[model samples]
Target chain A: MLEKSLKGNLGYWAWVLFLLGIIGVGVICYIVQYNYGLGATGMSRDVTWGIYISQFTFLVGVAAGGLMLVLPYYLHHYKDFARITILGEFMAIASVAMCMLFIMADLGQPMRALNVVLHPTPNSMLFYDMIVLSGYLFLNVVCGWVVLHSEYKGIKYPNWVKPFIYISIPWAVSIHTVTAFLYCGLPGRHFWLTAILAPRFLASAFAAGPCLLMVIALIMKRTTKFDIGRVAQDKLVTIIGYAALLNFFFLGCEIFVAYYSTIPGHMHTLDYLYFGLADHATGQVYNNLVPFMLSSVVMGFAGIGLIFVSRYLKSDPLLALSCLLIFVSFWIDKGLGLVLGGFVPNGLEQITEYVPTFVELGITAGVWATGFFIITVLYKIAISVKLENEKTA
Target chain B: MDSSRRKFLKIAGITAVAGIGAPSALNMLMKQEVQASSAGDGHGAQPAAHGGEGGHGAAPVGKRYGMVIDAVKFHENPGMAEKCIEACHSYYNVPDFGNKKDEIKWLWQVPFTNAFPGDESHYKKDDRTHAMQFMVLCNHCDNPPCVRACPTKATFKNADGMVMMDFHRCIGCRFCMAACPYGARSFNWRDPRGSKDGVPFIKKVNPEFPTRMRGVVEKCSFCDLRVKRGLIPLCVEATGDSKAMVFGDLNDPNSEISQVLKARFTIQRKPSLGTMPSVFYII
Candidate 1:
């Protein structure tokens, strides 16, 4: 039995080594970016923000997804979520770690990020975002630890912990909404200059965040002997389907308001993002790549269709595939769509194209790997804790 | 519960400290009072100004610096704008070349029609070769939005009407960049101060308005450093008394900027924005 437990541990070690090798290469590229500056990235005057910011935006939703799972389980008393809630908390910790890394990569003077805490600007949405993100990170970590310990002992949580669990429910929604406010509150950007952007971010997060959680559940089921109950998995899928539906509806409303009003400023952003505008005269695009217009339409419909299909929802592989597609679709919509759309057609109203550099791509990869590495370590520790509890029982 | 109690006590102690400290600080800093309706009212019109120089306290004598550009003349002599812009950029240590993502610009000319869209235009040209007239510098508005948006109060309007950015205190959130209607703000995406070596006679920088590092937002200060030293703006000096770039007290009737505006048919950029821009131009 001991040999079985220890058997081929070298494989796990080698897998970690491979991850580290990729991380090492990413680190070398990141150093090059630091030496040369953000100019090493795809960012340009017309497109001042790029992949780093978009990735940060995308991850905030993913991190929030963990909370959405936990809140309904603990607060709403959904005992079906008991098995998977630890996974949710673990996912949150990883996703938040990634969100922070991506943000730090985008800063011009990465060292000065510490100054944000020392000299907090209360008026700026960024200040509030820092507070909420750090707070949620701490809350999930502590709560997850406590709950996992309780489960090991086969004991119920003390009455006091429930209140804290309840607080985290809404607090999770606040994280992505505030991030949306960071972009949408800015006055001049015609694409982001809307009040509905925050709600849309929350809707998309719910849609994409839970879908990712479902896939993570499936991955664990495939690799590990630990059996995640099918009922629990089905409930998670249903939640994701409903969230995606809301996300699609909200997106449709945004398009409706833009096209129906006939305001050139409002409509221009939609025309560029969804429908390709005339070549280069006024639009942010030069050759009209039509990345957003087509990607959003195809993936968005596919996501909605999969959610509505009973067989796709029931099948683990189809469910995982649909979740992966929806996640990618939203990532493109939020990351590429929101950021690129804001900048296209420079402030001077001139059209200039932006392309990302290799160094920028490398740093972004490093950030993503770091986030994954963090999750892997945390989940390992959590599983160890669970196993230790089972042994005592 | 323990943390909340600690937090509560901390807040109460701070309030107590503030209550005890405020009166004495106020007395030492501002003892004299004048019959003014609000703080925004003209302090110059106050009765007992203060102890420093006559009744008016140690309040600074501020000049509401302005520019009255003749766009018609600039249309002919494009070289005038180029010279003025170069002077401002060199004085401020703006970087010359970088990716558009990281470009730092203190003062550069933008086309007038682009600068102020929806204005009444008598001249229109379809010729592909013809360029529109350009306005060269910061508007330095009366109610400057940059001043309001700055989190650290780093960008502030001086008693004398110039809007200045205190580089030392700036944390560089770039909110001021978003707030400016004219798109006047620029962020230092790379080390802008390193570019200062090429400019002659601008060797040292003041810590109060230090040479900015990467990632701080900067804009035209209307040459506040020149004003503090009692010199006219570098741009105005470059104009050689042609009154091409006018600078003076907008408040004082006798000031050059006021005299020119009253005399000529002057127009401010995007007056509909209601920023009350100090800079004006004569077509």
Candidate 2:
């Protein structure tokens, strides 16, 4: 397996090198941020969390999305997904790696990470998030490695691996749920105060995770000997299509509750996000996020329309385009809208506009580059074995 | 060696029982020790061990500390806020970044409406009819959301009612900032001790207080250091003794704060959130 991946020509190595180059840039930027503190970013006392936390939250959903395939294939015995279960697991691995990196980037003192473990508090939602996330990451690693290792050798995985696979199903839900609890349990941030946050996280995760998998599967199909089967792709698109609908439904539910109740506490965040609310002292209308959030809603619907048209689903390019749109929409909704929207009209009802600095964006790109690199390497190994197996057959 | 299911079950059972049983046993022993220590040294609510080590002195325990602010005094004097602010920052060695984004404040004044946005009018409404500015700091709540949101107990409610922070222990997650309804906490976006670009805002350091490193959350500890030495909080002492700011044990009915609360109409910030804030403002 290693030999196959290592033997790739100029293009493959260039791809690896390209990822490495971005990672190098990221390291330099991180070093600057580390020296100067969080001041290097645009985050302030008003918006304490920014790109790092938002990305961490979204990636938790992507990491949990592996269970989208795992549960259906394992528990429900939906065997169409069997061929691509390993793909979901591998995607989870990459996403989890990035999730950890994002969390580290968000920390004021990265070296003090172990302090969470040292002085654990059961009352803290963040404590639960750290626990579930690391636990899921471990489960994915062991199960994915063992299953792939056995598959490469043309032997069945040890019977011992089944229990971990079973446990991983519910554990997947826990990761995103706990992450939601991190925001949802806060006293004053009304944007995340709603009960819809966890379920909404799951819905968006289901949509974005599988949409990413479809794109990854398309890449595997074009570049490798693996088919992933049209049946598998269709089944996944079907799951993602309904999930996109559910994501929209949850968003609608949140908006309706805020509007109908007419509670300024709830409605103010929505107003700030959708239409810029007026600032009192300054008398200036602040709608910094309106365009981004409105466009996200529009793009999300457009992606759903593309998914259900029946004609577009048959065209791989169209489906891929739809998935890419969905990925962007959900990322914007959760990663961009959630953190900033949660903070605008902050605890003191003060509006401090937010924008990420170049250093912040560079660190973000570096995290994604790292995730893509991990995914590329792992897929190279898996695709090689699949191609070899096909040739032998 | 005990890999058998029955052996595992037996060990697990004992461990479960001990887990439930150990804490009370320890607490009972500690209560007796605390009583013995209190009798010997007049220190109340002192734990035998904190973070696996003994402490130097009296801990605020069994006493629920509270503060009553006379907003009218600050309203009349105006300059009193300046004195109190100066006293707090100098006493705490709080940093000054000269930029609002990076400013670290323990106690400060905002426009009156910002402090009581809900009561005066919507935060977006500009009306000077009920406008009044006053000093605000950490509420040190009975049900502090910051302490609850902290993954590590870096931010915690002391046995006394004060919300306390252990700076060295914080991982700088900033969940506490989101959790506090009062907007009380501040993150050291950069090192508070010195400036990187050579324009230093921290004019002097308080030798008695430890300055914070960049990437940690900090806020008022209700003058825990001064409190340990039996001194009133710096702000309270500077504000006009018991007239401008009252600090006393809420658990004691005879305490000045308790009597103040009994007589005057005092409002705690965001009491609707049920955080049971120790700090109250009198109009």
Among these predicted structures, which one has the highest TM-score?
2
lDDT tens digits, residue span B1-283, model 1:
3999979987997898678556545653442353333444765553222212221222234445667776666666668877887777676666665345566666666664555544525325433212556664567767665665554556766656567776656655555664666667776655555544465222445344446666566778887877879888777777765667778777678987778888888777666545677788776
Give the DockQ-based CAPRI class for model 1: incorrect
Please state the error at residue A121 of candidate 2 in Å. Answer: 1.8
DockQ computed for model 1 against the true two-chain complex using alpha carbons = 0.22
TM-score of each: 0.81, 0.90
Which 10-residue span in candidate 1 chain B carries the lowest summed lDDT? B48-57
Please give the range of 10 consecutive residues that has the lowest summed lDDT in model 2 chain B: B48-57
* Local distance difference test scores for all models: 0.69, 0.85
Q: Give a tens-digit lDDT track for model 2, residues A1-393.
A: 556667776878999999999999899999999988989999999999999999999999999888888888889999888777888898999999999999999899999987776565778888788778887888898898888888888888999999999999899999999999898988777888878999999999999999998888887677766788878888888888999999999999998999998988898889998998988688899998999999999889999888766334478888888888899999999989997889989878889989999999999999999999998888888777767766787
Candidate 2 global CA lDDT score: 0.85
RMSD of 1: 7.2
| Among all candidates shown, the one with the greatest lDDT | 2
